[model samples]
Target: MKFLAITLIVHTPHPATGVVQSTTERFREVLDNAVLAEELGFDGFGVGERHEWPFLSSAPPVVLSHIAALTSRIRLFTAVTTLSLLDPVRAYEDYATLDHLSGGRLELIIGKGNGAAQRELFRVTPEDQWARNAESYEVFRRIWREDKVSAVTRFRPGLKDAEVWPRPLQRPVRVWHGSATSKESVELAARYGDPLFSANVTHPIEPYAELIRHYRERWRHYGHDPARITVGAGTAGVYVARTSQEAVAAYRPVFEGNLALQKSLGLEPVFTTLDDFVERSSALVGSPQQVIDKVHRYHEQFGHTVLHLHADAGGLTRTRHHDSLTLFQSEVAPVLRRDIPDPPFPWGPVLHAPAPAATPLAR
Candidate 1:
């Protein structure tokens, strides 16, 4: 299985101590974390995009470009680029440039982002959000694949033989659709034969498992080979220790703080306690063996080939956070890699052969 360390760049104060860092320090923390993920041999390092308060990830391309300059091998990902709120032309240009800057190490996970604040900022109605997302992706896909494209859409002005420059280094850049309780996203992914990444952060596994089942069913319905279907899953959080008791104790404060924050934001508290979170949610707080067992259990349900653990430490100390990841790499990843197989496609952009050049449209 491929392992990715991902962060939303949340700017909340320390849950227990009420301490916060300067914006500069927080940004540095994210960059340093990306470097560390590369140093520790993670397959990918992802930066999320959120335009609302408590999240500093509004500019993913900017952040990922800096990460690209610092790391050599670790693939950089937009945890979920808010395509619904962006112009596909601009989004395509930015990521396409990033693809070249990173030597084709860029992979995108696109979605209709959540948050009322951002939807209002972008002037997108709730009724039109899914439609906007689908249209944006359709435009974005063509922008990456074809040159001098002409298209008309309700969301943006018509493009007549427009050339989006610095085309993607990847022949057809790999895009994974981010799905959370949305059939539109799943069906869109199936229609295009792209992979699906489950935003399995909140609630129990059944809802997410059902979504994956739907994705697979639609993939078969679309006449795509079952063997070509790839799925990725996200965890609630992760903190591994030598024993389950030790892991729980270490992560208790973090979980409690998060639970309180969720209530403050008017979000429903899915798991009341840390024990419940570990039992129900995708949080991987346990001994190495226990963590492995939980992953295996979920694998049986989701058949996921890629797994992402929270890169943000939450309320844990930096030292403890570093140690947890170290332990995960040393203990957890090897066992899982032995048991799980990777997706059929290459993890990063395929760069050995030159992609076909785009032909100009006839006037």
Candidate 2:
């Protein structure tokens, strides 16, 4: 299995302390984490796009460009580029430029983004967002696969033999549809035979699992090779310690504090307590073995070959944060890599050589 460390660059105050980092400091922290993820041998690092308060990840291409300069090997990803809010041609040009800068190591996970703020900021309504997402993706993919394109689009101006400059370096970059609580994204992925990445952080496994099943069914309907379908999943959070007790003790407050944040946002949370969150939600907070077991349980449902963990420190102290992730890399990650079958998307146009899972000291 391939592992990725991704952050939305949330700029919220510390859940427990109410302390917020300056925007500059927070951005630097993101850059530093990208470097650390590469150093720790993560397969990829992803920056998310969120155009709302308490989220500084409004421009993923700019963030990923800086990350490309810092890491030589780890692939770069957009957690879920808000294609619904972007002009497909402009988006294509930006990512195509990034592909060259990253030496053909850029992959995208596209979606119709969520949030009331998206409507306010981008003037895209929920009623129309999915349609915009689908149309934009169609044009975006065409830009990558074809030299010039002519098409009529409702959301954007018509294109006629338009050549998007600085053609992509990857022959064609890989795109993974980001599915959350919808069949539209799944259907789109299946229609194109592209991979699907589940935003599995919210709610329970059943909803996301149902989406994957739909994806597989549609893939067969579309006459794509079943063996070529790829899926990636995200955990709500991850923290490991020597024992479950220690891990729970460390993460409980963070969980409760975030639950409070959820209430403050006026959205009812599905997992109300730490126990429930650990038991049902996709958070991986426990001893190394317990975390591994939970992943296996999720795998039984998700069949995900790529797994992403929260990249930020969240509410943990720097020491605990670094140690927990390092321990996971040294202990938990190798086991999954050994046991899980490899998915096809990781082998891009320019295949990267596998690196040691972790440094000798970490092992």
Counted clashes in each candidate structure: 0, 0
The local distance difference test score of each candidate is 0.91, 0.88
lDDT of 2 by residue, 81-107 (tens): 999999999999999999999988899
TM agreement with the true structure for every prediction: 0.96, 0.95
lDDT of 2: 0.88
Say what the RMSD of model 2 is.
7.5
Candidate 1 residues 86-201, lDDT tens each? 99999999999999999999999999999999999999989999988988888888888877677778888877889998877887888999999989999999998999999999
lDDT measured at residue 173 in model 2 versus the true structure, 0 to 100: 81
Off by over 4 Å in 1: 352-363
TM-score (C-alpha) between model 1 and the true structure: 0.96
Give me the overall lDDT of model 1: 0.91
Give residue 221's lDDT in candidate 1 (0 to 100): 95
